[model samples]
Target: MAPLRIQPMPTYMDIHEIPGGITADEVAKAHAHDAAVEGKYGVHYHKYWVNERAGKIFCLCEAPNAEAAMQVHREAHGQTAEKIIQVEPDVADLFLGGSEVNSAGAVLLPGGAADARDPGIRTVLFTDIVESTLLTQTLGDDAAMELLQIHDSVVRDALKALNGREVKHTGDGIMASFVSAAAAVRCAAQIQRGLAQRAGEQSNHPVRVRIGGAAGEPVEHGNDIFGSTVQLAARLCSHAEPEQIVVSSVVADLCIGKGLMFRPLGEVSLKGFDRPVHAHSVEWSA
Candidate 1:
């Protein structure tokens, strides 16, 4: 008879929403409670983020199932989570990055003082060279390579200025993550504008690109950042016109009062998503 295989428990990110607000100390006590009882349920509560001003707390844990994870909370402090989403541990580490955890298990900013908490929210951005294959076909290998270099230079420069981190290069595009949604939007705009100026100078290549951005936690379904947020950003990028910028509604909402302009694209159908996503077009020209 073949031996039975035991599957690994999944990692989950659970959100807790308090009415007024919550403090780090309060969450620390709650986390201590959870840790004391989690072993009984075969669950492990890892780290947590507390947005004191926003009255939100995000806890990362591993359990046999969502119910098992919640049961630990229910038995410990009676403060059930608002929602729990399974996430890919590797991808979460990639996007959210690692942080310093206090003895209480609350995540803190990487080099910041004890009070500076890391929110665990991130903005994901993608940039694709419009008609990259055709550009290569028409411009020849050497010229296409030159234009690609220009794209890399401009995007990396913008990322550096806006504090964005390049996750990976996608051959024809780039994927990046930002701690601030406003910074991500600004970075996208800077890239588009920079490319436009470069296009005018290098009229021969006239490279044009499209950008898309979305904001969300690190919850994901696959090894890669195929999380809904990342997927929406990629879909919006493909849906954009040449030299244009498109972003998800949450990105727009997060950029409110940041002096950016976005025209509503309404709800648009996107591949791999069950429902239509509301998108916005960022005005980056001039």
Candidate 2:
């Protein structure tokens, strides 16, 4: 037998079809799930399009291979995949590379006016209340909303402390942006620890929060993050345990020169994104 020849991971796309009549509420729920899984797996290029004409849902993602992408979809939402296709990242990479180059060429000093022509790579933080489903089930709907208001308030307070901007709320979840990867990770850990303290004080109803982050050039849209990087951050938070913070290799790369320590969790190929993205789950308070 000849020596084994290792093959390069084939870049591909995974298409999943969600059920028809997926309501706005369902889309919100599904999007949350998608974001969380994407974050956990580090797939930074995902686009969703609904096709009512064919009564099918379209999800375009970059992945190392069909198998890896399929695994992501299955593990993320337990959804059965419909189609998977091979792709050449070279073409898309050219476009992505150009964007990065343009961003680097621009000089945007902090607190100074800068053109919105570039998509500057930055860290994105996503935080959300944990066990929200059980809470709503136990507490009345109105009471649940009131509790969420308080939870949001606490989160906002901490975010403000860190000089972060809230991207938006996906129901109980909040997406935030930061200039520094270390700061974003630190802020996430802080929120988790602080929320845990608050939860410990509540004997009847403890509220926990899960946090995750990714650092990359997130497409900016007003105050919201609109790129695959942002989606990946939210996905990481979704898969995270209460008070746990998960980060991507992109974030890990940014903190290389910095002194922040990280515990590596090996590699995971997220849905729709080509190549395996190294992942790390930051050590937080037990």
Candidate 3:
């Protein structure tokens, strides 16, 4: 499995081409069947969209695997999915928060400022919420929103403290960039540690974030960051346990003797990487 993932697990946005047009009642029946039996297959039917005039419908789900997402519909409702594609979400803060980053990809200290854009060499960071769907189901939208707000605040505060540039939100996660790999790693640890401590003493709805990072130049497009570095960071984040921080070899190399502790997990296979990547999990035990 690719860790706990930003959206809880691997997600597939399924496409259904309904030649006869799907009806509201028919969709309801399928949803009911899913609600009844999805747990059997370790899947969650997130939602669906209907285009009656065009005879097209889109279904969203979080499943252990694509096969599971397909099997649930095949066995339960006979609506075999035409396609199951893994997807990433698009989310970001209204604006970038923290001190400005310099042209040389250096973070200005607090109360300092710099220019607007620099897609230069940077340490990209990613973090995700665990089992968020279940949280939303347990607590209504209103309540879940409350917890998410706090999570955003905590993340933003940590980024500000470290002078990280808030790139965007990833639905249940956040993406930020740092000029220094050590700062990024330390900030990731801080986010996890602080949230863990708070979850320990707070309300019944606990919060956890999986943190991961990689170092390299990233391509900025469509107001979002991309390229292999960002993807690898997210892949590592998905491989991280709740309240855990994982970093790539690039990050590990950059943080050596920087007073950061990392345990090497040896060569491990990460999705989309040509070969297994040697990764390290940040040790955060007190």
**TM per prediction:** 0.78, 0.55, 0.58
**lDDT tens digits by residue: candidate 3, 1-286:** 6686565687666666678775555665776777678899999876554444445555657899989988888878888866666655332111122324333322234342443222234688998988888889999899888778878888988898887888778889898988778889988988887787778878588788888898863222222333577888999999988888989998999898999999998987888878898889998763
In order of lDDT, best first, we have: 1, 3, 2
lDDT of 1 at 79: 96
Number of clashing pairs per prediction, in order: 0, 13, 4
Best-matching candidate per lDDT: 1
Candidate 1 accuracy as TM-score:
0.78
lDDT of 1 by residue, 34-134 (tens): 99999998999999987888788889899999999999999999999877888878766767776678888988865456568887778899999988999
Which consecutive 10 residues in model 2 have the weakest lDDT in total?
Answer: 98-107
Q: In model 3, which residue pairs have backbone atoms overlapping below 3 Å?
A: 2-238, 3-238, 91-169, 92-169
**What lDDT would each prediction earn against the true structure?**
0.86, 0.61, 0.72
Better of 2 and 3 by TM-score: 3
Sorting all predicted structures by TM-score, with the top scorer first, yields 1, 3, 2
- Model 2, span 1-286: residue lDDT tens: 9999976555553444455544333434554566567655545335443333333443446555556666666676777466655545553332122221112222132332443222244677887788888889989798789768767877788777876777668788787777667777777777777666776776566667778788753222222223567767777777677767889888988788766778897876666556666788887663
- Candidate 1 Cα outliers beyond 4 Å, as residue runs: 1-12, 16-22, 37-44, 52-55, 61-75, 78-90, 109-116, 220-226
The local lDDT score (0 to 100) that residue 142 gets in candidate 3 is 90
lDDT of residue 70 for candidate 1 = 99
Highest TM-score model number? 1
Error of 1 at 119 (Å): 3.3
